[model samples]
Target: MRCRIPETTLREALAAGATYAAIARAHGDDPAAVRARCVALDLSRSRTQGRIPPEPVLRVALAMDGVSVARLARAWGCHPDALSRAARRLGLPTDPVGRAALRGGR
Candidate 1:
């Protein structure tokens, strides 16, 4: 099952550099639940054996309806280009639409 964060707020918080655990705390959800949504969104690259990383956090932010990669990267204390490269390195689809396409196997 998917996690319980409101898709909109998850995006907002993520863009603000909130970790999955912090986002979950903000929304009164289990951190694992937050991680699940990140996974479902393909925002998470690594398997869920450990903590969710900043890369996935950026992914989720970029996947939000109006969030931008540059904005999220700045919020996360990194250069936009670096975050962009990290997303690519983690095998995350850069475009939100492309990520969505992945989820539905389109």
Candidate 2:
């Protein structure tokens, strides 16, 4: 089944400080989908907003256990490549899947 949550309502709720996850729950939509939309919106504003990522969040992303870059990006509200670059800056592993594949290499 499809959700009845209007785009305007979703945007309003998020603008009012309601997280995309909360808005999705309230509207019976997928949180991931809502979050993706929100991230896209945020990226569109990044050019003019000058928002900087927190250092702690970068650390958390680098140290996240068994977390994929895609998952980290979702949590940090940014692109996977951004998180990967941050990890590289910290000398942490960048490609999770590549590392996993290497572990099984003969």
> Which residue runs of candidate 2 sit more than 4 Å off their true CA positions?
1-63, 97-106
Show where candidate 1 strays beyond 4 Å.
Answer: 1-55, 99-106
Q: Look at candidate 2 and tell me the lDDT of residue 71.
A: 72
Ten contiguous residues minimizing lDDT sum, candidate 1 = 44-53
Residue 61 in model 2: lDDT? 50
lDDT of 2 by residue, 1-106 (tens): 3445666776688667686678878877887777666665552123112222566655545555587767767765676776666667765565666445434541
Residue 27 lDDT in model 2?
73
Model 2 CA lDDT for position 24: 79
RMSD of candidate 2 to the true fold?
A: 8.3
Tens-digit lDDT track of model 1 for 9-77: 776776676788888777778888898887777665332223234665755665666667666666666
Query: At residue 70, what lDDT does model 1 achieve?
Result: 68
